[model samples]
Target: MTTLRLGFARGGLEIKQFLRSRESVVFTLFFPLLLLVIFGSVFDAEIAPGVSFTQYFAAGIIAAGLLTTGFQSLAIQIPMEREKGILKRLRGTPMPRTAYFIGKVIMVLAIGAAETVVLVATAAAFYDLPVPSTAAKWVTFGWVSLLGISACTLCGIAFSSLARTGRGAPAIVTPVALVLQFISGVFFQYTSIPEWMRTIASLFPLKWITQGMRSVFLPDSFAAQEVGGGWQLGYVAIALGAWVIIGLALCVFTFRWTDRG
Candidate 1:
């Protein structure tokens, strides 16, 4: 209980420090919004009868934003901190390692919620995207967000152990993130992608996360357009839940307090 309390306090400091950085603010917070605007403008067509391309794209962007906050950000930030001896210093403190990770999870959840709101609002205001109106839909949104954020954040912490230096972190993380986005249908319609690509994407959390977001925001009929011609909510839940478990295991095994080879 005390560790959790201290972790929350640490999270507060993390949020404050994050807000102070202009580059982080723009890249982490606004980059997804920029992608939304550019894609929303360029692809001004209906994905379905009443749904514009922007509406469909919005959910994917929100999923991607969660990835950026939880996965890409932590993957890069932790290694940089480790290289700077910040994590090493923290390791010697009375704080438990779990508390440190709890702090990171809090930061990612807060930022991810804010990012979701901004993306949904922008889509509604400019693209006529409708918010989810049903209680069940909101419930779906909540669980998906929780599981997706946790999976990505823990995986990021685990992946950070692979980076040998601050300078190498982006090189290791960015390409993987970019490839996931492209292949997981963040930047394109999932059904439009090749079947083999979809099969590969099914192995990852982003594909399931994006599909779950679509289930929440899109019409029920839209599920017919998915790879299996259904929303596959059961599969979505299973995939993300599995990743959460896998990520936790990886974090336990691979997390490092220093950038040691």
Candidate 2:
């Protein structure tokens, strides 16, 4: 109980600090909106028979925002904290290690929520994205968002173990993330990609995340555009669940207390 409270306080501080940072505000908040506006403007027509390209891409943009906020942000921030001796100093203190990580997870979840609202609003306003209009659609969005935030946050923590210094964090993280995004159909039409590429992408969470969002926003007829001709909500849940399990194991066994190595 005491340790949880410590984490609660610590998480609040982290969130406030992150919110105040100008760079974070731009990247976390505005970057997705910009992308949505730019690409959505260029591709204005329906990609499929009834679904506009803007609608098709908007879901991907929202997922991109959530991914950037949780996975990419933490992948960089953790190493920077280590470089600054923040993690090392915290480690030397009596603070519970779990409290520190819990603090990070709290901060990421808060950011993820805020990013979702902002991205969804922008997409609806600019791209005419079919908002979740029914109870089932909203329910799907709710679960997908919850699982997505969890998966990305855990992946971020586990991947942070790879960073040895703050200076090179983005170089290491961004390329891998971008590659995954491209392959996962976040920045392009999913079916347009080759079958082999789609096969490779199936192993990752972002593809399933995009599919989950499409399920909620696109019409039921849009399912024809999907890989299996349906939403595949079960696969989304299972894939993200697998990632959460993998992340938990990696964080426990391989997480670096400090970026000394």
Candidate 3:
């Protein structure tokens, strides 16, 4: 209980620092909106059969928003903290090393929840999508989004340990995230992509996340393809679970509290 409380305190401070940055605000709030505007306007229904460009793309944008808030943010922040000797200074205190990481996870979870609300509200207003019509769908959305956030946040921490300095962090994280977003159908419909790209995207955690969110908000009849027997529920479980496992293993092996490492 004490540990958790302290973690929350640390996380609150982190959130405040991040929120104060205008660049962080843009990345957290407007970057996804920019993607939404570009893709929503440019690709009309004529581009895809049976799919509304705005509605179908909303899920992916929400997924992207959450991923950026948690994964990309942590990936950049951690190494920057290390480069600035923040982590090293913290280590000199009595604070348990894991507390620092735990605080980061809590901060990311809070940010993810806020981002979800923003994206959902925006989708409802701009895309005319129904809010989750059933309690079951809402529950599914909560579970899947939370799980996805957990997996990605841990993966970010694991990867950040590989970055050498503050400058290297964004260079490494941004391009990778951009590539994944491109291939994961956040910017384009999956059906429009070639078979090889579709298959590759299917393996990415972002794809499962976007598809799972759609399953919660969109009608079942609206699903473009039956993945994992139905709406790819099985695939979501596998992809997220695999990433969580791999992320934990890597963090265990590589995570460092001190910049000197």
lDDT by residue for model 2 (236-256), tens? 999988988987898789888
Ranking, lDDT, top scorer first? 1, 2, 3
Query: Per-prediction TM-score, please?
Result: 0.97, 0.97, 0.93
Clashing residue pairs, backbone N/CA/C < 3 A, model 1: none
lDDT by residue for model 1 (70-111), tens: 999999999999989999999889887778888898899899
As for candidate 3, its clashing pairs are none
Candidate 2: 10-residue stretch with minimal lDDT: 252-261
lDDT: which candidate is best? 1
lDDT of each: 0.90, 0.86, 0.80
Of the two candidates 2 and 3, the one with more favorable lDDT, higher being better, is: 2
- Tens digits of per-residue lDDT, candidate 3, 1-261, equal 767777878888888987898998788778887777777677657333444767778888888877897789999989998888898899888887767877898788877888778878887887766789889898889878987888889889998998888889999999978877887767876666777877887766788888888788667876655344367777788889998898889999998877663
For model 3, what is the alpha-carbon lDDT of residue 179?
77
